[model samples]
Target chain A: MATKLLSRYPWATSPFVIGAPMRVMSGPALAVAVSRAGGLGFIGPGLKTTDTGVDLEEASSLIDKARASSFKTLSSSSLLPVGVGFQLWSDDLSTAMGTIEKYKPCAVWLFAPKEGQKDLDEWSRRIRAVSPETQIWIQIGSLGEAKSILQSSEKPDVVVVQGTESGGHGRMADGMGIMTLFPEVADTLASSHIPLLAAGGIADGRGVAAALCLGASGVVMGTRFLASSEARISRGYQNEVVRASDGATNTTRTLLYNHLRGTYGWPPEYSPRTIINKSFIEHRAGTPFEELKKRHDEAAKSGDSGWGPDGRLATYAGASIGLIHNVSDAERIVRDVRNDASRRIQGLAAA
Target chain B: MATKLLSRYPWATSPFVIGAPMRVMSGPALAVAVSRAGGLGFIGPGLKTTDTGVDLEEASSLIDKARASSFKTLSSSSLLPVGVGFQLWSDDLSTAMGTIEKYKPCAVWLFAPKEGQKDLDEWSRRIRAVSPETQIWIQIGSLGEAKSILQSSEKPDVVVVQGTESGGHGRMADGMGIMTLFPEVADTLASSHIPLLAAGGIADGRGVAAALCLGASGVVMGTRFLASSEARISRGYQNEVVRASDGATNTTRTLLYNHLRGTYGWPPEYSPRTIINKSFIEHRAGTPFEELKKRHDEAAKSGDSGWGPDGRLATYAGASIGLIHNVSDAERIVRDVRNDASRRIQGLAAA
Candidate 1:
């Protein structure tokens, strides 16, 4: 059902490159830019407010503005529809459903549900009832979770296989790499006809090409887009991403950063990957959480500079930070990755 | 220097796929088959005797037997020169050097040295002094190691970047995945002109394609080849490799298996990935080490049947085991992966 819905989009002409719904980083402008570039773009879950709902009024206006911009060269059919992501565990279902109904996004990404597969099933059913055209995409990190989803009645149109290398909230302790996880999930769901999207540590054309080879119909990239111009990121965070050389040493999966930033309420089974900053350093050095939190609050006052080597804030990023060398536009990232993958594939085929 | 040496081989015509020198599984027969199939084959470190040096006489005879077989279709030049691997810390250096000097293999892979970078530098210099034609390939799992190698006066011809997902011995606690690690190492050594080979979780065409996109000149696969007919793996181990589906849950990095199997004295930094059998289950369930060892010995007496779900033994494999559905020939594994990668590349390019 989800695969059938995805076929209606313009991804047939080009490989699907998704601008991942990365918390505060993925915003309306980023989504629109990516969609206009012939790839699916998703507004992150951070946009959904607890009291009101998904800021659909703001999102609708932003989408309109993006459509009205210099993207006139894009065919009406070629203009891919935008997607919105929601954290099922933290979100209010009724509010989220209302927002989806109001905006009618092309797709909805469901992640980190509070009540497991049943919650996801209910969410999928509700979304389908409200907007039958809105494709349901579910993100999973383990084979067990994938199996559960496969058995569930609320089958997703697309399954985003997230590896442990991904940034921001993922399977904490028992996560596998995308290289193995993606193919495993692909093989498990081979008979189900559900398209798979490879996520985690993919930052360039090579990653996109590899994901495709692994049987993913598309790729959902977060860290790569975090360095993009349209992403709602602070300069310090973006610069750190560009300057980071070794993702293995620079990035670590920990909740210490989350605690210092006061962003609690995440489930126990999940942890976010972050560039090791001063706060992380101090925390690892055995500083108390209360002290670190106080220092983090003070550091946050410095605005952009609060996220450098010496700063005390979290620079949430995947190990792929080493692959990113610059902060470019979202369109360029998508186009370059697609073109480079094409060139490589062509070269190999010819060889 | 390594790049120049590799160029002399026939890897340029196709994706450079290598049968990794897995400790016990990679034998002369497997190496010859992979080489005959147009991929570099390596005789693993297991051939190195602690006292007598590498059993070069046996290896030589095996190589001769392989050459005398139906591999006449392979041109002498296309028959990639077989490489020999050594665990520097465990093997007698002088005796191993004698074997390399006599055999003069195409490449020598050095891993787990006692004195770190300086030791590797000395080993490379010695290998070159004896056989200037033989290339030095150093395997590293982290960027720190890569940087150290780059800074060393004695440089290697090829750098094998082994991710945490690889089977056998690899970085234990602090390791990065290949998707991010390979690119970072590539960029760091971009100007050095050293060729990079990606290892770990690379099972098929997509893995090969992805590694190339990430700037790898080739890929060294271990676990995938474990399912190859020519590999010197036991029937039980091979069967487990074929039967395993969820590698993330089925395999783990632990010294318990090594201890039970009585294969100790490994460097503190390295740990092998193994499939969870009865031994692992009992160990994890808080069974005492002595009791588990006693049970493992009893199970080993049963031969092949002692390695299944209820068996008390280690099944060494990578997370990519989910991709292997059969135990075929080494030549087929190499050729199929190359062809598949080519096909996927072509399809993506056309798309």
Candidate 2:
């Protein structure tokens, strides 16, 4: 399974690291940099369906530049090395398929379907039809979801088992930690020949090594990339990500930020984990939503200042934030994690 | 640190496994069996403080019998090979200390102090005074709790970082997954010389391998031990532990079962994760606690049938229940997990 997964991306190395497509934050620069550094990078879901096409166009240009430069090892396959993610329930299938038809990203990460596997089956079928070479990577949070996928007409080429510690939107009430969740999902889908990737609460090489021990062919990191230099984020939000510690207390799974930002209608079963700020604090302390919304709007107009402990903007992140101490380029992050994981794996073996 | 931890218990092997001292369930037979299997075990807190002394006396007899049999590897340290646990907030310290002084257990596992680290400091100091050879093992659920321990006057010889997915009592709100929590706590207390053990949702070899990769010197199993043939558990309760699946939905952290069992006044920060039963279902579905408690009392008189999907007895188990298929003796369970974990660790290193 590990060899099969690595075969899809020739430039990638072992203990495969992935820069998760973290909504708007994961963009062309980060994706291209990660792939150039022998790791897979994914462009997260954009604000609009057509925005994906724009990111792919930028990614194509970046890859072309990298090929002409030092990164001559970059794959020249018909499908681009970078992948793209979509929020199935909110994203328009036709528009996403159109983008995939054009760029033909190596993988399509499908998540948060309103009708679960049935909805995933439709999107998987459509996306595969549009881009035959592209792999379908479905993200599931629970074992039940994994079982449901097996019953679907279109099975994912890869299953990313996300634990409850994941950032962005995840299973609100039915999520377990990846430590137990991953191995169970792997055991259940062992015969399927689909490679499993562990996601959520993974910030560094220690997490990467741990994930591999849990039977993950690869590991996906969302929060760690939020601190990457290439992330498309506000200065304050980035600083907050760097400053946060003791994630158990600093981060929470809440939808207040989503509503405060006027972004509504996420699937009911999903909610985003974010760094706590004044907006959520006030809301929980008896401030009305309307009043909080007014304060959020005011905070947003103040530029980079709208993203600290006192800031009202949502700082969607994972519980692994405390482990991230500084910002670095995507390439460095990927290489460091890969090297650290290798060292740790070797060290544990010797011990 | 791993070497130091193993040196303290010469009978234990690398990737050390410990049977968690589950309340009443982890008794003399289970503890002695685990120790005999070359894994450390701790007798769980008893119904009363005096009951601990009774369990220890039985454990002494079991060790004597085992030594006369095939288990010649057993240590002859003045302290017993098996450890003992106590719930600080509710337990009488003088009584527990007296028991420890008599048995001289290899370790003392302390948990749920009413005043946090201060309470732990007092217990550690007193336990050390009573039995100097007994190692102090402190269980913490969050990074904040880990940080607080560093400031205490009495330092623990080992710290068990318990994630929220643990069965029995755990942090109600602040607990994060062990995948993230263990590494951060390890990084914070790197120079303390304390061996950090990963707990919560750990059942088999994959979990054990993962914890070792996360820098855990050892791994602890609480819920998994509940299914051991030697456990002091009812047949129905053991059946429920094996029957449960999709722990994300089947298990929850709630105090309803505790309150119904007439076990109250647990510190506000903690709650036990139990298999969902008729008692919890009705309570969540608007059934009054008074009516539920009445039904619970009647169900307790019906023998082992008091546990299951419809049973009202508290089935305190971790989210890893789905992975457990059957009951085995503590020795077999320990040997299987240890051997499997070693195999997986070696396999991952080669990969």
Here the TM-score of candidate 2's chain B is 0.98
lDDT of each: 0.81, 0.90
The pairs that clash in candidate 2 are: none
Question: What lDDT does candidate 2 reach at residue A27?
Answer: 96
Error of 2 at B349 (Å): 1.2
Which docking class does model 2 fall in? high
- Number of the predicted model whose TM-score against the real structure is largest: 2
Name the weakest run of 10 consecutive residues (lDDT summed) in model 2 chain B: B70-79
Best by lDDT, which number? Answer: 2
Best-fitting candidate, scored by DockQ: 2
> Which residue pairs in candidate 1 have backbone atoms (N, alpha carbon, C) closer than 3 angstroms, thus clashing?
A2-A157, A89-A114, B2-B157
Candidate 1, residues A140-238, lDDT tens digits: the string is: 998988889879988998889999889888997668888788888888888888888899989888888778777788888999998899998889888
Model 2 per-residue lDDT at A82: 95
lDDT of 2 by residue, B82-126 (tens): 999999998899999899998899999999999999999999999
- Over A1-351, each residue of candidate 2 has an lDDT whose tens digit, in order, gives 888899898888888998898888999999998898888999999999899999999999999888888887775566898999999888999999999999999999999898889999999999889899899999999888988977777999999999988888898888889988888888788878789999999989989988988889999998888888899988899999899888888899998998988888888888999999899889889999999999999998998899888789989999988899999988899999999998988888787
